[model samples]
Target: MHELQALGKQLVELPAKQLVDIPLSEKTRDAIVAARSFKHGAIRRQLQYIGSLMPKEDEDAIRIMLYKLQQPHKDEVRAFHQLEQWRDQLLLGDQDLLNELAIKFENFDRQHIRQLIRNAKKEQEQNKPPKSARLLFKYLTEMQGK
Candidate 1:
């Protein structure tokens, strides 16, 4: 079936270390490893063979494991977007936003944040590199870590 082939393809794409982490049988692992080195038609046939073997294995469990592996990357991207939103809000010269940040971050350096905002705005106007914006992002990230 197409779903089985797709699962086989996913397995082929996984790194060896990740494959090891999954609860695959030794036979399935060996088949996948061998398939990795095959060329063109041989690789396709090997993948189909792996697909045939999938029914005997716990296909749902393998898919769940793959999803778990990808979850952290999604979390990181979401966090980065949140940081960008915060940076943009601060750059918009909203004093209330800064107050909210100060309240949230306790030891937030108000003077440094204001200075970075000014420099970032100047850099944007002059079409220069965003050195100050990067500094601001780094500061915010560090504060979040704490």
Candidate 2:
């Protein structure tokens, strides 16, 4: 399995503690951490590399950015397609300008992820059953798949 798919699968299937047991090689785990820790063109590069490892998966990791950023569905999917293109490489012609956009977009993505975690924890706390971390992980992981 490619690192991207493995990480994505882990993000979805494994609980937080179990995620650490997903058996990723150190390099693959490092790559996963790197990709998640920063929002940049590296995400595409990492996806491509992961896809390369798993020849069966040519599909790039599009939702990595979208899910992490918790962006809403805009008028059309093209907006997201274009945004990913901009991040992956400046299809826009200028590198420096795109770098600025990447930074701002990355910041938004980070904030979105933080807010999601906070909201989920808050909701869990108010629930009749009182969600556990494992349950919270399951909810988060499942939602990201969509």
Candidate 3:
């Protein structure tokens, strides 16, 4: 019963577009939509109502679909973290890693990277804004697409 309420809370948090993808009954969907417009105590009561309605639905299927919907976001976050790690490593003068990146990205421009790194280093030493570092990140993002 509590688990159902928790699932109901998760369902309510989903955007309308995502809610459309989940297989929900009209009544449950209506309840969720209504809950979205409610104030605090009313929303809590609505969630309890939704939880009560959850038992009739296939819990496993809904859970699976929810996981599937969230997976792409998780993957994107992981990739962004990897890019940040790569950027940090490059800034630390990882020549071997830079060489590896050159091989990995066919469009990699070593000279451009060198210029960016030099500018970034100079900016750091001079206490200027990290304009080049941001450009490096933007370049890396484009490189990632290819």
| Alpha-carbon lDDT, every model | 0.91, 0.45, 0.93
The residue pairs found clashing in candidate 3 are: none
Tens-place lDDT digits, model 1, residues 54-127: 88889879989999987898999999999998998899987998999899998899999999999999999999
lDDT tens per residue, model 2, 1-146: 56555645444333345436444445555555555654567666765555444333222443343343333545336554554444333222344644465465433343343444455466656883433333434433343334
Model 1: lDDT of residue 142: 94
Cα-lDDT of candidate 3: 0.93
TM-score (C-alpha) between model 2 and the true structure: 0.27
lDDT of 3 by residue, 47-100 (tens): 999999999998998999999999999999999998888888889999998999
Error of 1 at 25 (Å): 1.5
Instruction: Please report how far candidate 3 places residue 97 from its true position, in Å.
Output: 1.2
Highest-scoring model, TM-score = 3
TM-scores of the candidates are 0.86, 0.27, 0.95
- Give stretches of model 1 more than 4 Å off: 38-42
RMSD of 1: 2.0
